[model samples]
Target: MSEADFIARLRGIATDPAARGLADDVAVWEGLVLTHDMIVEGIHFLPDEAPQDVAWKLVAVNLSDLAAKGAAPLGVLVGYSLGDAAWDKAFADGLDTALRRFGLLLLGGDTVRVPAGAPRSFGLTAIGRAPEGGAPARSGARPGDQIWVTGTIGNAGVGLAMRLGEIEPNETCLAAYRRPQPQLTFGQAVVPHVHAMMDVSDGLLIDAQRMAEASGCRFGLMLEAVPLSAALLAVRPDVVDTRLAAATAGDDYQLLFAADPAKAPMIREIADGLDVPVTVVGHAGVGEGVVLTHKAQRVPLPERLGFMH
Candidate 1:
């Protein structure tokens, strides 16, 4: 199918105000909104992976970006690389499933075929409306703000290991990589109070460092306090270094946020109400480097904390 035809098909699926036909030029609402993400085969996923999972992931990854910004999903535009007709249908079915699962709709999309023997790639451009007034940005974190992460880190990393056969696939670990739940509800619940917020896609340490750099602050993480899933513990009980690597590894789509000290109680209350685990990993300080304090001594951190170019 051609890109225009794919888009026309999507236009028929859902109708939303933001997605209504535009005459080539249109003015959008102001504030922090709109997010786009692309995933390529071999880089983001294996070429032999299931088409349904790939389709779900394409949308989920983009939605994760919006969730990090505390934005509610408005709609999506899919950009696909054409393949077999049956495969394309499966992909569309998966995309529809994700859209309904997240209360998002497919506005439009484009599709194109890659040359034979070329690398495969797909992209999803997600549009979202910032909550009420504005969306959270990485530059908003302040000194003394406590850093917290929703759910356990490193599950996706561990799941990747399982995919590579470096580790055995367990129910917990495989679930992390295959179906990551974007913290949309959590982001909305905390948007009003968070000083700064971001989703931990590129590992906690690296993403946290990025947040620090953007906010002109430093982050201090207590290595002992970082949370790990039971599957991770079972695989490598004494592998502190592996845990640290997972903490810095990419693909875990959980939210890492900072908030004022005064709002700690409220944050806990919200987490409890939502039944999501929130861990206070560290604190933001008035400096420019990420410090990992372990056993009262500063540890030499990894040179590349997360995904690197």
Candidate 2:
């Protein structure tokens, strides 16, 4: 069975409304937002990847969930799989760097050793406080709400291509893959404005589809409206395929949100204050699924919207 299928099997086992039927990324418990995320060495990161980068990814991904909930991080509890002294030390340095970079604290954690040659795995539990307007939900989107995305869409996808040697490495693209910046302050500022919000850790389209499913609305997205970084466009030709790839690529860790049309100016101001890029990619409508368009022409949805697992 698929990982998603397996997760669905566990839904009824928990009754807390905070769990959101296992639909949202993080559990909202009163004023506290709780999340746990796991990453595997071979699956989530290249085996040769720097320990520091892996550690940073581990922390950043979880914090991104908090960002989606419009929460201020309080601390983290890490579950570590020890490799060697040198590797663990490097991971510690990376973890310290990530914590300091985000102004977070390490509350507590445990470490363990795996069998020889086993793929390294790590998990993190992040605790955060919801914002004044309360934590927005993936299922809160209303019809006619504008779909907004923070930052450029496809830089990390390009970075992944570079990491896999499919494309030559560049500073901007490589940095995107190795280090992702979670939109903490921006998320907090947006909580009061957004009807629904989430972090784009998976490909933009897949995550957006999730929002659509949760919201019970049709999302009409303009292909040309999706933002792309100069770095991504420089390495990839400006074409439909490039845009599709960007939409379907994962690991961007930016925010995807829906707000009323009237909130555009306020949203832009918030983003401007944070020095983050925010764009209106589409709008929600009184229907289901998603509709794609390019230059006012309807296009069939891609066979794959984004990462499945």
Candidate 3:
């Protein structure tokens, strides 16, 4: 079964409200927010990819979930698969770098060794404290809320192309794919102001649909408003496909959020304070599902919004 379908089945048995009805990325209970994320070799990363970056990606992805909830990370428990001695050593170094970069600690973890030739898989469970205002949910968006996104989008997708020889490697694009920085500070600073929020691990379009579904609202997104980094456009042409590709290419860990239109000035201020770029991409209304538009004209939805497994 698809992961979403499998999760739905489990939701019937999860009794705690902190489970967030299996809708939100992180679970919240007793002022603590918990999140777990797993990355698989060949699936999430290329086999030749540096072990350090793989380790960082595993930790960063989980921390991104905490950032969505505006939770301050306390520590993380990791599940690691032993591969080779050199790879393991590099992963350990990467783990240390990521933890120090994000001001997090390695609490404890367990390790196992798979059969020879097995792909490496890693998981991390991050524990954090919800901000003073409380953890914002994915289901709290209301009608007439403005949709916003932080930082740039689509850089990582281009990075993947560079890695695959579809294009020449540039430092910006390569770094984006190898290391995704979670917006930990911005999430905490803006948590109190947003109605609903989540990180864009999946494509912008897919994740927005999820937020719309959870909030029971219709999200009208402007294709042109989806931010694109200069690095991506420099390698790829600036056109409709450029924007659409970024919207549908998952892996950018930027924050996607909903807020009141009146809060735009404040939101801008917060972004400016952090030197993070924020843009208004759309709005929410009393309805179901999402609508895509370009230059005020409705556009057909892509056959696939993002990665699905």
Q: List clashing residue pairs in candidate 2.
A: none
Candidate 1 lDDT, 1-309, residue by residue in tens:
786677667767635534323211111246435666788888888877777888888888877877877788889888899988887888788887889999987898888988987766887778777788566667788999999999988888888889889987898887788777888888888889898887888789988887898789999988777888878888867455866877887788998898999999999999999998999999999999799876556877888799752
Give the Cα error of residue 188 in candidate 3, in Å: 0.3
lDDT of 3 by residue, 134-169 (tens): 999988889999999999988998899999999988
> Each candidate: what lDDT?
0.80, 0.92, 0.92
Provide the lDDT at 218 for model 2. Answer: 92
What's the lDDT for residue 67 in model 1? 80
The candidate 3 region of ten consecutive residues with least summed lDDT is 300-309
Kindly report which residue stretches of model 2 are placed more than 4 angstroms away from their true locations once superposed.
none
Query: For model 2, how does the per-residue alpha-carbon lDDT over 1-309 read when each residue is reduced to its tens digit?
Result: 677777878886767898988889899887899999999987889998999999999999999999998999999999999999999999999999999998888999999989999999999999999897789999989999999999998898899889889998899988988999899999988899999999998898889899999999999999999999999988899999999999999899999999999999998888998899999999999999989998888888899988765
| TM-scores for the candidates | 0.88, 0.98, 0.98
Task: Rank the candidate models, highest TM-score first.
Answer: 3, 2, 1
The clash count for each model shown is 1, 0, 0
